[model samples]
Target: MTQALTLARPYARAAFALSREGGRTAAWSQALAFASRVAADPQAQALLGHPLLNPADAVGLLAPDGADEAFTRFLGLLADNRRLVLLPEITGQFEELRAEAERVVKAKVTAASELPSAELDAIKAALKKRFGREVEIETAVDASLIGGAVIDAGDVVIDGSLKGKLERLQSTLSQ
Candidate 1:
């Protein structure tokens, strides 16, 4: 995993620089996401390293509409280099760069059960205030949490889940 990310960093950085300069960050984001999904598909995965597959065919498979000249060229380069498998990692790093540039942070919120919109909105508001940036919340329900929620915002983790509290208490008692 780490190796893949390391290999993908330069490609992601180059793509990000191009998109930033072109003022087409969102378009590039969509294109990368689409290409990543295509590359991740089972059929595409099988074809990635096939000796007989043409680079143009691979690029066409991943980007049917040819989003733009730069993106098409980028896809061709990846296809030529047999680096299609790295699309997901590249897309992720690109998104991180885009988010940082846009002053947006993605927060993963895990709760015991589905949270109401009002509660989610309140959490978003609080997180926005805390991070001083736009908060994009992605929520999931984990019954094992028992109660409360856990907010994972990059380096900051607020473990309010009952399971987390119990674990901390147990650790303290053990010490």
Candidate 2:
């Protein structure tokens, strides 16, 4: 997985750069996401590395209807290089780049129970302040958390759950 991500990074950056230059960042993002979904299907996965697969056919399979010429060419390049299997990783990195450029951060919060909208709003506000960017939050309920909540904003994770606190306390006493 790490090797695939390392290999996909350059291609992702190249795609991002081209999309930004062409002023088609959003379109490219949607197209890449579509391609990624297509490549993720089990049937498509089986054919990605098949010796008899044609590059054009690979691009045809991955490219969405009415895909722009440049985007299709990019898919063609990946197909020719036998790197089409990396589409999912490449799409992920591309979205990260797009999000960074747009100054948006995505966060996930898990709590022992469903969070109230007011609490979720507060968390979003705090994260926006911390990252100095607009924040989009997705929430979930995990009963194992016992109490409190966990906020995961990519590089930052704040684990304030009762379960987490008990584990930490146990570790400290053991040490």
Candidate 3:
């Protein structure tokens, strides 16, 4: 994973730069996401690795329909370099770069049960105030949480779940 990220970093940066220049970060994001999905497919893996596979065909296989020339060219470059298999890593890093550039905070909230819209909105408002930036949240239900929720916001993780509290209490008592 370390090596993958290392190899993919430059390509991701290049892709992000291209998107920024073209003012099509959203388009690039979608196209790269689609290409990553295509490249990660089992059958596509076999095809991409085949010695007979050429760069143009590889680009065609990976590029989404209606992709812009710039993005298609980007895919061609990746294909030419035999780096199509790194699409997933590149896409992930590209998203990180995009998020940082846009100053958007992506977070996940896992709770014991489904949260009401009002509660979710309150959480979003709090996070926005805390981060002083636009917060994009995704929510999940985890019955094992017992009660409350866990907020994972990149560098910050807030474990407010009863299960987490009980575990901490137990550890402190044992210590």
Best by TM-score: 3
Q: How many residue pairs collide in each prediction? A: 0, 0, 0
lDDT of each candidate versus the true structure? 0.93, 0.95, 0.95
lDDT of 2 by residue, 1-175 (tens): 9999999999999999999999999999999999999898999989988989999999999999988999999999999999999999999999999999999999999999999999999999999999999999999999999999999999999999999999999999999
Candidate 3 lDDT over residue span 54-146, tens digit each: 999999988889899999999999988889989999999999999999999999999999999999999999999999989999999999999
- Candidate 2 residue pairs that clash: none
CA displacement after TM-score superposition, residue 123 of candidate 1 (Å): 1.1
RMSD of 3: 0.7
* Candidate 2 vs. true structure, TM-score: 0.94
Model with the higher TM-score, candidate 1 or 3: 3
TM-score of each: 0.96, 0.94, 0.98
Off by over 4 Å in 3: none
Pairs that collide in candidate 3 are none
